[model samples]
Target: MDKQELGAFLRTRRERLRPEDVGLVSGARRRTPGLRREEIAVLAHISTEYYVRLEQGRAPRPSGDVLAGISAALLLTDAESEHLHLLAGTAPIQTGLHRRDVRPSILTLLERLTQTAGFVTSATFEVLAWNDLAAALMEDFGALAPADRNLARKVFLVSDGDGRGGPLYGISDRAEFRQTVVMRLRTTMARYPSDPAVIGLVEELRSGSAEFARLWERHDVQSVPMLTKTFRHPVVGDVTVDCDSLALTDRDQHLVLYSAPQGSRDAEALALLSVLGTEGIDMVPDARR
Candidate 1:
């Protein structure tokens, strides 16, 4: 195991974080940028001396539980999390190969959802196929370059007018949205370490958006909830709909359907969006940012 590299990596990860990131009160007089070793130790339930040994490259290899605690404390990304295992000489975590191809039946399902805003995405969140309602509601994925048909990159890099990007699907609760996207991307990274699409997207986002970089470092992971989401469209106004994700079994592709209940204002907005078609619709602009 590369003990020295592990120590250095851990130290660097720690230094990049601020106290407020982990719920600690920031002291004005502190000299360094991140949490102290003692604070990390306390958070990890380890002794200060043990953690110091870890940083000094003298400590024995850490167990899985110990690594998990450390990972949580430092907020390592999926890549960072796996790298920690290799450096620690432990068994690698299994983020098995993710399926990228969309099944025929899934495509049929997407097409059948005429009243709903529907689309299919690869494991890496690449926009594979989207309907007219989706295009009208959000940006036109079909018009985007195949390489640019990525959700994470659009969320983090694309701008409406200024350098900063516009709101995602006009969702106002941005923090929650960012967290959800980042978490899912991390899971995908773990599952497909060698995927050029996922890796390139990661590199692009890290270089482009400081916010994405910070969120990526946090290493959040979870299932995207089957919850109702609100979208504030420029033409149709506001529409709230339930977002449902259906996995295409072994194919690993996802069919995402957005639907509002009948007779609801959101349903009306969706209808208006369909009628509006491609008019008053613009997607992630320039992308030079």
Candidate 2:
């Protein structure tokens, strides 16, 4: 069990709750945020001391019943409740390196996805494979070294050089995407805590980016779904597309497809990108180099 992380997660969730959120009265002006430990203990039907110990990281592995109580007390969502189980070692963990290999059929599907920008991302958000349209819509991932293909790295580490933030493909959902990256990485960390790459990547992001560090400390494990996004492509000006991410369950990866409705201007832009390829694109904006 990841005792420290579990404690941290519990603490964050508890602090996000208001007294009235769980039907408790706001008796007085509060000194700290969220419901108090005693209040949570009362709500969860556990001893205040034990809940405190759990938050202090001094408690033993909580039983399933105890965890359920705590989950209810904190009003965790389904994803957050599952994360609580993972952190407490009650759920099955991957316990190995995250898979990076893209299934051959997925690769073929990417190629067959005509006029659509398609790419597969590993558990850690590494771009494992992409079609020509993906390269055109984004940058040419095929030209980047394996280590440079990680989207989390690109999101947090690689800056746009104008003090804005990381290279976000000039996408309009930069903030949302960053949160999604952090939330998914938190899940990945719980699943593959022993994986060197995951460990190293988390360490690198925490140290390199203050934004990442702040988000990491929030202990969030759920991401709001991004339905549509607009990309300010250097060549195409703006191309808005519907975002569809299909989970490759066997490989623990995501096939992310960006497509615009047929007969739309965005669709025409995608078509143009398909033919242009990455001929005029540079992976990093020239100013960054």
- Which lDDT values do the candidates have, in the order given? 0.75, 0.90
- Model 2 TM-score relative to the real fold: 0.96
Most accurate candidate by TM-score:
2
Candidate 2 C-alpha error for residue 46, in Å: 1.4
Write candidate 2's Cα lDDT for 106-135 as tens digits. 889989998889999999999999999998
Best by lDDT: 2
Q: Give the local distance difference test score of model 2.
A: 0.90
Model 2 error, position 218 (Å):
0.6
What would the TM-scores of all predictions be? 0.66, 0.96
Candidate 2 segments exceeding 4 Å error: 280-289
